[model samples]
Target: MKSLFVTIVSLFSLSAAYAQTWSVDKAHSRAGFTVTHNLLAEVDGNFKTFDAKITAAKPDLSDAVFEFTADVNSISTDNERRDNHLKSPDFFDAAKFPTLTFKSTSFKKVEGKKYKITGDLTMHGVTKPITLDATMTGPVMMKGMGGKEQEKAGFKINSTLKRSDFSVGTIPVVVVSDEVEIKVNGEFAKQDGAVAEKK
Candidate 1:
């Protein structure tokens, strides 16, 4: 019994030592979306403020966990009037729901560098499960601010969601397409000495 207990503890410690945390480099990251307008053209927009993090134990990030949050007020479409209208009650009501968030429940590899991430997205006080397709690039070692070697990775994630699912807007589908295409590109830097144990 004693030997078995020691063996289990040793294995646990080894697993914990492999876990790492990577933080988004906001300067090189962007969260944006596109939606069709009146069947004529597509409107593009993006959120100016957002943050995300990833935790994993493997180099391939097959068991990674992702968490993200974006400030609703930071939304921008280049037009002040339209942006303001989006913040009103007819749309996001940013004052009441200040932020949108997502936390991954599963991260599975579909092929080389491609993954499917399923998570719960919370927006406008509604929480729903959503899946996103992601492509991951290098956890390459690069020189950093102090000329020290740092590990960096890149990700491109995409998804399509319905605005009505989150009670986001009251506009008719004919005026604005119901399907919104989301695109997120980010570069993450692995934190030094940040150990993240698996739950």
Candidate 2:
């Protein structure tokens, strides 16, 4: 009976020791995406305004909880007219649905610093299931430009999505690939006072 009590205490302690929380630092972070323009060309773009919140239970990133939002008006392709067109009713309709959002449902760790992040992507009044293949880098301790810092984390996620799934645009057997390839690289600062930080 005494052995069982000791074992239970030890297991609880280990569970408590492994949980942590982190925050997305926008100033030091970025959100980007790419799509085919007019069927045959590649256009690179990014959202200048966005926010994110993240939580994790371990360095492995399994069971990490996260949510991100991008301001639809902040979309930029480095051109004015095309940007305006994209914002119009034919495309994003930013006036009606002004933001793109993602919220994680689950995270499953894969081999060697990689994870499968499954989530819901809400855009243009539609929400769809999306999974990003993610790679984690650097939870390494380092000396800050100002002082000592511990475990800085960064991630890269790549996925190919069909815009048609979300009713983004219609293609009538001409011009572009309905499948769009997108990649997002993010850097997060360990948020102080985050409840998950200790995990």
Candidate 3:
């Protein structure tokens, strides 16, 4: 019994030691979306400010937790008028809900470098469960300033959600499609002192 208890404690410690936290390199990351406009053209926009983090124990990130948040007021589509409207009550009501966020509940590997992530998304004072398709690349080592070697990874995530489900927009479907497509591309850097074994 004593040996078994010691072995279990050791295993737990090893697993905790292997977990790493990777932070988004915002200068190289983007959170963007597209929605059909007038049943003809598509309007694209992106948030100017957003942050994300990933915590995982495995190099492949088979068991990962993801958290992301974006400032709703930083939304831009190039046209100031439309952007303001989006921030107003007709859409996001940015004053009431200044930020949109997502926290993952599950991260399942689908194939090589591909994963299905399910999470709770909160926006415009509402929360809903959503899933995204994700692809990951590289824990490539790169030399940063001062010639320090750092680990970097890239991710591409995509999802589609109904705007109405989050009470984001009340515009008729004919004017703006109910479906919104989200695309996020991010580069993450492993924080110092949370290093995992190289795959």
TM-score (all chains, Cα) for each model:
0.90, 0.82, 0.90
Residue 94 in model 2: lDDT: 93
Residue by residue across 73-147, what tens digits does model 1's lDDT show? 999999999999888888889999989999999998889999999999999899999999999999899998989
Ten contiguous residues minimizing lDDT sum, candidate 3: 190-199
- List the lowest-lDDT window of 10 residues for candidate 1: 190-199
Q: For model 3, how does the per-residue alpha-carbon lDDT over 124-164 read when each residue is reduced to its tens digit? A: 98999999999989878999899999989999999999999
Q: What C-alpha lDDT, on a 0 to 100 scale, does residue 9 get in candidate 1? A: 96
Candidate 2 backbone collisions, by pair = 19-198, 19-199, 20-196, 20-199, 21-196, 21-197, 39-175, 39-176
- Taking every candidate in turn, the Cα RMSD to the unseen true structure, in Å, is 2.5, 4.3, 3.8
- Judging by lDDT against the true structure, name the best candidate: 3
Q: Point out the higher-scoring one by TM-score: 1 or 2.
A: 1
Residue 67 of model 2 has an lDDT of 89
TM-score of predicted structure 3: 0.90
lDDT (tens digit, per residue) of candidate 2 on 46-138: 888898876765665566777899998988889999788777876788999899999999988778888999999999899998999988887
Regions more than 4 Å wrong, model 2? 1-19, 171-173, 194-199
